[model samples]
Target: MATFAEPLRPNVASADVQLPGVRDYEQVDTEIIGTLKPTAGWFGALGVAIAMFLVGAAAWIYQIYWGLGNAGYAPPVMWGVYIITFVFWVGIGHAGTLISAILFLFRAGFRTTIYRCAEAMTVFAVMTAGLFPIIHIGRPWKFFWLIPYPNWRLIWPNFKSPLVWDVFAISTYLTVSSTFLYVGLIPDIAVLRDRETNPLRKRILAILSLGWRNSEPEWRHFMKMYLFLAAFSTPLVLSVHSVVSFDFAMALTPGWHATIFPPYFVAGAIFSGIGMVFTIIIPIRKFFKLQHYVTINHLDAAAKLALFTSMVVGCAYLIEFWVAWYSGVAAEQDYFWNRVFGEWWWAAWIMLTCNMIFPLSLFSQKLRRNPTWLFILSIFINIGMWFERFVIIVPSLSHEFEPWQWGHYVPSWVDMSILVGSFGWFFMWFLLFIKQLPVVAIAEVKEIVPPKLRSHARGHGLDPSGHHLPYGTETPGEFD
Candidate 1:
């Protein structure tokens, strides 16, 4: 709830030697590592997050004892909140890959300010998402049966089924994302190791650092491995979401079957993911007094990204409707009509407003740069995207096939509790992470700070002299 106090470097010249957010290069570590030490407010937020997770855990326990009857599922609409949320969280995980991998490959410098936290979100978002399928299954104890494994009976899991793909895709995604996050942290961890005065903390940091000495040979190998992993991760980000879309598009059910789904879902995933990053990083910058590090310029770039993706998604919506009209498919036409005019019509309208209408506000540079507006719009996008998934899943199921078989589904308390809990679990992990590790990558960010700034600051006695600095210093270079 705290606000940014430092004036944003909006008109900063292109030729400025030092990056806008940083002054002396050596101060990057001190600025970032301070976040590892928590305040009372962080503890308070952590408590709330833990409480939310516990609420969901209690609901799951109750459901386990009472069976699926404890949930909202019934008749034609057997899938409800869990499936919607699964899609939501999975979509939320996409932006991290977009920022950390795709943008890195393209050589974007802005990513340095935000990629660490974004990557953390990707890992935790997937962890939250991986839960729903298990929770949705009537017998979670047998969820492992979904996995392909050697057996004496010689019966393998269904390779043709997208359900099986979900199992493999999500597990593989979590593994790669976790590795990406830890790999990025190694250099920062070594920084922590060197700074620590306590013996026990140093030992833990040493184990985590794997003897990283930041030597030239080590730096060469690290960059190669990091880029190799990024290349490997690039396709997985695309494929994992495409496979998720297949879960629906591969089905022939009314609104579910379509060629547009793969791209639509991917765009929606990135759009929602970017929105969430805004929702997160805004508070982080404000509360942690990181305005200098995460400037309005950084936020503006992200807002532009969210706006572009939102328009792409908005076009996808129009295309689906146009295709339905042009194709003359009765089921598809009925599904679209029902979505707009039938039961849960409110949801359809809400989704359109959130995903299509609200994002249009970002077209104004004034609104995009306004932190308050950006935060509100980001929350709206997240909510709208969630209902977009709900509208897609539920209406189709509610009106499928024979009128006699059709039935409506309503969310039970269990559904609401688990939904709230999943959010809690996610933030809980994120808060703990920020408390224990540098929220931004100190090394990557330092690469952008002009060495001249440090020299100039030293000349003015604004910072300590170069030789006395402990974080290692680089000599200043003249402009080309």
Candidate 2:
């Protein structure tokens, strides 16, 4: 609403940033809220997502019925694709919080157009990631045992296990991030509520909006709450993935046992997360015709960040080999050597090329700005990152202490089906979300658009729409 608009202010690099072309608050609402109206394509995509998820659900049901043996869990390589995907999805969950919470803290304007989708991606990715642990345990029903509750039998989870650490880290991150997302959505939801014609939908929106009236007091409290959540969620950008990295760092396995795991994993998580964001947003931008709001400049900024993280990840890769060779430890050196030149050499090379080499193309401004090129590269990044996890987990576990213990791990159809299903499960939720809510934040985007004077602001405490303008007392010159 016009009442929610802040005072006119100059946006940074006003020339370069592609601010939305809308001239008034009403246009912003029309353009954004208008996207919620779904079409045939929306239903078609939703159908595909549901189909994929059902196929995966079938695979999971079969796995549960037959047992974990149906999976690709060979002797030495007990971890297999389940564990690899668990880590990958966890890493994928990082970018949303980083883009939303960390960027907000730094006052990055580019994030305003993109953070809402990224935040949703974070929540859904985590929900997807949470499934793996239960699946890996081969017992979905007993997952509650991981919780530290007062059980009559006094049985408890091992606190030292990194899996336990993941439980706490992921659950905490999910709670805070979702709450942060919902809070930010309140005002925008209020906007939808005020504009809705249907009574049924209006009632639902009202309840979700918590009776928001767009009052000065509400805006004041909202700003304060958002700021606090931004600050609170920032540390999680680094900590959550760092805790995930501990799954490997704290392990005695040669490839996994390195102090660099925390920062390295953190960097890779952000990189992969950004890649997923690009993958999801690019299609949405095209189909939804939201080019003005989610512009090339926003993609370019995201590309640059992805490129930066790629470089960090590249350095971490080299440092891994350097550590292995420099330490002169036979087992560690052998493990590193076997990783690149061993049975799973193809997987290793894919990791190297996708995660490290391919991203280098982003250094070129042309490639970074081109949406098509960026989308392709994002696909490569996601593939490479998944293989990166595979390389870390399977290789280390397969070729361990004794040559007799070494084994080749190949994923069964069931394992592959579930992996395919995870993507389905994630996209299903995301597709439903876009149709149900505003993908772009109406209030934040308005903040970037330069303000204007309304007739009601002329010595009257109201805008043209009869909504109370917070800055109506100020003269037109003050806005300038």
Candidate 3:
């Protein structure tokens, strides 16, 4: 077992010039020391989160006891706030997957710190999102009826039904995401287990670490497994969000039946999800004094990604209107018009302004670099994205083809309480995660900012990779 100060040098390089890629494997020990210290701000955040969780839990219990009728979901508005928030939270989950999986596959080096927190967010957000459909079910107890089970009942979920598709898609996504998050945490947990002298903490971490011993072979296999998991997660993000979009597109409702729904939904998901990443990360970084690691660079990268996705969402909005007008479908045209000038016109405009126009400011380098502005912009994007979901779900169902069936939908108190509670629920889980695990990837960061390597390479006038033999491999003491 190597100590934190014992640096592992490449055989070819001198001891003083630290090589990149896991030089100080024991740095994890120092990192865990800070992570275990309880802070006032963390406890404050946790307190609020717990309160919110309790409120949400009580609301859910009420729903279970009193039934779905309490939620203001009548015939015309079968899907209300629960379904809308479900889609909203699920969309917010996309950015994490995109950041962690897609960017990793592309070798985006900046993702190292960003990916861990975002990936953890993805898992918890999905878990909270998955609860909506189950709670929305009128008979919550019979939720398993949607599954294909071999039993005396001899029944199967309808494969053709979009709702059933959502069940399968979201379930599969949650499973994969949770597995990915847990796999990534295993080595980090082992680091904690090795460092902790406390019996309780050591026992807990030992169980979670799964007998991991930081051997070269273990690290090699873990890296390969991580790469494989990343590959698997990339497609899952795309497919899960697309399937959610299909839930609406497959419907015959005028506004719902559009070819553009898939891409539009996915882009909006990324946009909102990235907004959430900033929403959570900015505060966490500031509170924990992790600015050195989280850095302005990470913020800039996330801002750029959010800006691009917002533009993509904006384009989707334009294309949707064009398609509605050009397709010669009367109902579709009416639906489009209703969105802009009808009862919920304000919502459509809010969505456009907040999600599209506001985030566009990030196009400026100044705005992207400004943390305060970036945080505000992210909050706006989140609000707008939520409104976007509300607009899509409600207005379409509210003002359908049949004038006789047309009705306005308003969320009842139970719905509002639960919606608010979900935010608390999400934060509760996230707060726990930050406390219990390494919020930043300790080993990965050490890999990125290897000490003495850059100075040595530069002194020898060698490239960053340090592959130029005599030119790159300086005597370590000279650089140190």
Give all TM-scores, in the order shown.
Answer: 0.91, 0.91, 0.89
Tens-place lDDT digits, model 1, residues 1-480:
999775333322122223444666567888888778889999999999999999999999999999998899988888899999999999999999889999888776668788999999999999999999999996889999988889899989989999999889999999999999999999999999999888999999999999999999999999999899889888999998899999999988888899999899999999999989998999998898888777766776778889899999999988988998888988788888898888879999999999999999988877977899999998999999999999999999998767787789899999999999999999999999998888888888877764543564545323444422222223221111
Candidate 1, superposed: residue stretches over 4 Å from native: 1-18, 452-480
Residue pairs clashing, model 1: none
Per-residue lDDT of model 3, residues 1-480, tens digit only: 876754332221112222232223354347434865878978998899899888888988998888788998766878889888999999989998998889878776667777888988999999899889888886778888888889886877789998888888899999988898888888778878888889998999999999998799999998998899888888888888889999899989978988888888998999999999999888876777666556565676678788889899999998989999999988889889999998899999999999889998987766776778888988898899989999999999988888888888888888988998999999999999888898877666666543434554354434455332332333331111
**C-alpha positional error of residue 186 in candidate 3 after TM-score superposition, expressed in Å:** 1.2
In angstroms, give how far residue 144 of model 2 lies from its true place. 0.9
Q: TM-score: which is higher, 1 or 3?
A: 1
lDDT of 2 by residue, 1-480 (tens): 356657232222222343534456777899999899999999999999999998889999999999999998989888988888988998888999999988887776678889999999999998999899899899899999889899899988999888788889999998998898899899999999999999999999999999998899999988998888888888876888999899889988889899999999999999999999999999998998888788776787788899999999999999999999999988899999999997788999999999889999987767877899999999999999999999999999988878898888999999999998999999999999999999998999888655655565463444576544443323221111
